[model samples]
Target: MAEEQMNFQAEVSRLLDIVAHSLYSEKEIFLRELISNAADACDRLRHAALTQGGLLGDDSSFRIRLKADPSARTLTIADNGIGMNREELIDNLGTIARSGTAAFVQQLENKAEGANLIGQFGVGFYSAFMVAEKVEVATRRAGEDRGWLWSSDGRGAFTVAEDADAPARGTRIVLHLRQGEEEYLDAQRIRQIVHTYSDHIAVPVVLESKKEDEPDETLNAASALWTRPKSEITDEQYKEFYHHVGHAFDDPWLRLHFKAEGVMEYTGLLFVPSQKPFDLFHPDRKPGVRLYVKRVFITDDCAELLPPYLRFLRGIVDTEDLPLNVSRELLQNNPRLAKIRQALVKKVLGELKQKAEAAPEEYANFWETFGPVLKEGLYEDGQQRDTLLALARFRSTTREGWVSLADYVKDMKPGQEAIYTITGDDPKALAKSPQLEGFAAKGIEVLLLSDPVDDFWLSMVPAYDGKPFKSVTRGGADLDSIGGGDKKDTAEAEQQDEAAPGIDALIAFVKLTLKDQVKDVRVSKRLTSSPVCLVADEGDLDMHLERMLKAQHQLDRSSQRILEVNPGHAMVKALAAQVGKDGAGGVVEDAAWLLLDQARIIEGEPLPDAVAFSQRLSKLVEKGLLAG
Candidate 1:
């Protein structure tokens, strides 16, 4: 067939430009990425061979070969694994075909910290362009007869043509070194890069010999890092292994390596990354931890091996108990697998607790990245809710940074019965919520929950340490039992309360005026700065939850919310006096609707009737102008 030329996918083209031009600080990273991809291809072949006969044929052994040629100005990385066919080459190399490609591109484009992003999105092939003026990939897929050659110059276009002499059953990538990239041509430099970054890769990485009499040299340990004893492994080895297994560039925040015996025998090498992966929250994202049985590759995407909440964790879990040919269907209901998962969860939570106590600052950073993900356990895994709750950290109205539930309970105001919280889309906005004013004034702290998962878990975890989780925007705040602030502020509040003699009459008239618009209109014990605020009725869903459901189209309509008026506010007092004198006339009626809309706006709820709100607001402003 004639050579076919094609323009790179738009996203891939843009990515190649950024990777080729700007990511020079860590140019050596391209070697690690290419080596990692080579190792993964071998693993895929190993796994595929388990089911298919003769897939490995004569070459049952797997290895990655590196050849650096100074005279030719070329470096080749070859892998004896599952090589790509023509379609696979174009789909995998010529395009960013994954679900989060746009997001991945944006992340790399925006942050220099995205150096680790290369291998993560399966776009690491393009990283070869970082040092190479041109790249050529020659491959023959395992169990296939045809071979293909793909070449690119990192400008805009690439060509794929049939190769008459490609490798029998693997891929070979040749990088034509750029003018000043002679460093990559040095065998010693390639050896050092392999030792630093690809040493933990399970596949043997052999450096091809340049001299006719010299033997090829193995550059890596060629043994699985997880299978080795923790005492024998160095921290650098573990980090490099994480880079290999996790397809990650960032250092691990924490690593857990342990072997369990007795009922079930298994070894787990788990890592929590310092930076969250771009697809951490993608609904279709699979667990990063690969599962192996008795040191043989099984599958990388076994959701049953770990709970979805812990999906951020990356590494491997190898078990001696599971059969080597275990299928995905059996994994779901396997009792032994269930026990292993439970033990794994307990171990991880225990380690996290120790870290939280020993080095709180470091643990706080981990929480900021993975806390929302971990909170999913509260709703899904009731068995480990207690441990997850203990490890959870939250921002609160009275605390800077994150506060634990234990800390929140310890600092509760005198006579405060429940653990107060307010839920919203933003933490800063939740802190300024009018529903929190009275609680804040009384020195009571309210947990400010902003994550969407917060609402789901709060429902499952009704109470903690014997105190119920109470939303400040739900029911009566009951802050009256909690003592007020300093004597001066208390006295001033009392004076304003006494000045508003028409408050009771105003509440009655406003309630009648907005009968259909609100569930109830009552003088609030929770309001101080704002004239009015909205809250969920005692029996209704929390305001935030209801709004969230409506937004998702799960709920057809929202339950009517209660409007709480601050009796001490000057505007409320004036409106109250007018209601008493005018007897719920047009002006007071307009004020009632306008105040309701203002409270809705403050709560971040969309006004039910925006046109009516605008008309009412304009009329109120015009009336004041005319009366003046």
Candidate 2:
């Protein structure tokens, strides 16, 4: 066929521009990307050979070879793997076919370290332009007779043509090195780059010099890093393998390497990254783990390999039992795959539990990085909820660092019946909540849950270790039954009870004045220093949940909250006295609204009427000054 020119997809053009100009911090990463792509091609061929007996044809051995010519200013990467035909070449290279192309480009434009985003979007092939002025690819698909050539300058357009003299099967990429990028033409430099990035690749990477007399050298270990026995793999090897697989620079925080045999045979080399991925919480974030059958790579972005909650986990799961021809659709409903997933989840949670028990400080660090993500399992994976809960950690009012539910229970005061907690968006703000003043006074601990997932998991999991999880901001905390506070508090409570008539009148007056704003008005046992606070009704959504729902545009109207008053506070006492004399006058009415607005402010809620609140405060201050 005659060569045809085509414009790159709009998104692809933008990506090419970024690679050619802006993404220069990691120019060497271009080599890594090409080698990784070559390895993937080899893996695809191996998997295809399982069903199509003739796919391998005469050359069954799969390998990647690199040749450099310093005099010619050229470098070639060749792979004996499944290669693309003419149409496949155009579709794959000329367009951004992925779902999140726009988001990926926006991220690339926004982030300084956006080289990883290219890999995430599967467009690493274009990275060659970082060092090459022009790139050429000649490829022939297995079981096909025709070969094709694709050439591009990493700009607006590319060309595709027929190449009769291409390799029998697989791809060869020739890069015309740009000026000042001649380092890639050295054989030693090529070998070092391959060893650093592609050492864990299962296929052999052979490096050859342009000189005819020099012998070719294998640059990589040419073995699957996970399949090797644990004792044989050194820490540095494991760390390098993690860097290659994860496309990350930091060392792994935790590594789980084990082979599960008997019925379900698989090897898992999972890593918990020391640094969280940039898109860890992105709604469309790609899965990090790859799926392999008998060391033949299948899919790296398969969500079936791990649940969404564990999407941060990066590594490989290679199974010997699964058929090499298994498709992703078939794997989803496959009972064997289900069982494997279940077992893997259990194994990961078990390792985390062991780490928490044996090395809490280390586990705490892991939790600090991934706790919100891990807590998602508590809501999503009901079958493993108990295990996830056991692994959960929280910041508490009683301690300096993180504390687990078990640790909190161990330190619980006598007669404490439930595990108390408070949910908000910030830990520092939660610690200052008026609702917790009473708990602090009684020396009772409260878990400070600030993550958006906190409210969700707590709803799914109401209790841990036989004690029900109680929110300190709820109406049913029942602090009196927990046997807290001192005798002085008891005597004051009795004295307030003797003045019950006056308190009751005050509560009635406040309820009448703020009838629509509050569900009810009552004396608060949960307030020690703060005069007023808001609490969710017995069966209503808590303040945190309300705020979250509103923020998401899911809830339009706020749920009415119960307004509680502390009779011991001077403000409440003065309001009660004024109410007894004048019977719900203007001063008493203003005080009632002021108290509600103040409580809302303390709970991090926006006042219903800020202008009114300011006016009321000004009037009260003026009156106080005149009386003084």
Candidate 3:
């Protein structure tokens, strides 16, 4: 093949510029990225050789070699693995093959935080430009006689040519160091970087010195960390392994290292990050785990390895029973994979349960960061719904910190029949809801749920520990049956009750005036301080859920709400006396509409007509001033 010159993809050019100028803060990350890519290539070749028989040829040993020459100002990384051919080299190195290029670039422009978008996009090769002025790649694909050389200067164009002197079957990347980047040519520095980052890689990473007197030395441990016995690994080794695998800077919050044997054999080393990833909620965020079969890398973005609810976990799962040639299509819906997933989920949940019990404060911190995400399991995983509900932590009107459902049940009042809860967008706002007034007066506690997922999970999980979960904002809440009020308060309530005929007339007149605006008008036992509040029907959707759906354009029409008036309030008593003196007239009708509008505003719902509300209020104030 003749040498060919081609222009880099437009996205590739933008990405290279970002990498060279702003992608990474530390220059040593270039070596980590290159070594990680080399390790992946070696793993791929091992997996391919399992079925291809002679693909390994005479050189069965798989390894990576690093050579640095201070005089030449160059550092070369070589690997005996599944190398790319001519077309593969161009497509992989010259273009942004994965999706979301535009979004990734936009993130770079918006944030000054140095992000590892390379791993997410599979463009770690371009990271070489961070420290190198130019890069040259020589590779020969396995089972092919021809080889190719790809050379680029971190500019808009690159050249490819046939290389007859390329190795038998692998890739060698030579980076020409920039002026100030000559420190990378130091052999000791290269060894230290490998041990710090790639020590857990299964392949041997050998460093060849520039001095003739010193022999070649293997810098890394050359064994899979997960495959080793748990007792043999030190805490620092485990932490370093997690840093390398997760591409993260902080230490892990928790680590799970275990092996399942007998029938299905697999080893898992999973880590929960101390802080959330920047893309934790990104719609296109890839999976954090990598799958392997007998220590050979298979796929890193396989969703089948773990349920979507646990996507925050990062680690590797290597199984001995899976076929070396298994493809992702074959792994999906496979019974073996399903069984492994089930077992892994159980183990993860059990570990979390233990942690929550042993360290309450630490678990509370974890919940603060990931509770909303974990609550998703209640709706998605029915089989584990009970476990998840029991594990959930909630904020309540009575507690100083988070309380579990079990603790709430245990702390139930003497005759409390159900667990009361209220949902909204903010906990502090929900705490001031008029619907909670009566409960507060009676010294009853209600859970204040503010997460978006809280509305969903509460609907799916109706009850816990034989006590039903009841929403305080719904009409079905039975405060009387729950022994909420005492005899003395009941007597005080009777003294304040409106005259029977006057109250009856007041209810009838208000209902008639607001009939078109509300589903019904009735006296309320749930409001102690407020004059009126809104409540949903027993089977109607939650108020918060309805508002959310309407805001999202998923619901076109608003559901009618029932308005409940507190006869004990001074405003309601005055309204009743006024209605008894005069029949339902325009003034009385205006008052009815104003009461309903106020309730709607308190419930976080927009008024049906804001202009009418303002006009009516202004007229009432004018009439009051003239009379005074």
Best by TM-score: 1
lDDT of 1 by residue, 1-628 (tens): 8999999998888899988885647788899989999999998899888878899988899999999888899999999999999999999888877787887888778646557676666577788988998999999999999999999998889999999889998999999999999999888898999999988998999999988899999999999888898999999999989888988878899999999988799999999999888778988857999999887888999988899999999999999999877887889889999989889988988999999999999999999999999999999999999999999999988778999999988877788889988888999878888888787676788889999999889999989999999888889878667774766666655665564877888899899989888989988887778899999988889989988898899899778889999989878877877875644488888889889999989988778899998898888788772243
Candidate 2: where is the Cα deviation over 4 Å? 1-27, 48-60, 80-130, 133-171, 209-216, 284-286, 483-501, 553-558, 580-584, 606-628
Preferred candidate (lDDT higher): 2 or 3 = 2
Clashing pairs in 3: none
Shift in Å, residue 312, candidate 1: 1.2
* Residue range 251-368, candidate 2, lDDT tens digits: 7989999998898899999999987776688777668988998888888877777899998899999998888888767778778878888888888888889999999999999999
Local distance difference test, candidate 2: 0.84
Q: What is the C-alpha local distance difference test score of each model?
A: 0.88, 0.84, 0.83
Going through the candidates in the order shown, the clash numbers are 0, 0, 0
The top-ranked prediction according to lDDT is 1
Residue 336, candidate 3: alpha-carbon lDDT: 90
Off by over 4 Å in 3: 1-27, 48-61, 80-130, 133-178, 211-215, 282-287, 483-503, 551-557, 580-584, 625-628
Instruction: Summarize candidate 3's per-residue lDDT along 412-434 as a digit string, tens digits.
Output: 87789889999999999999999
Ranked by lDDT, the better of candidates 1 and 2 is: 1
Q: Count backbone clashes in candidate 3.
A: 0
Each prediction's TM-score versus the true structure = 0.96, 0.84, 0.84
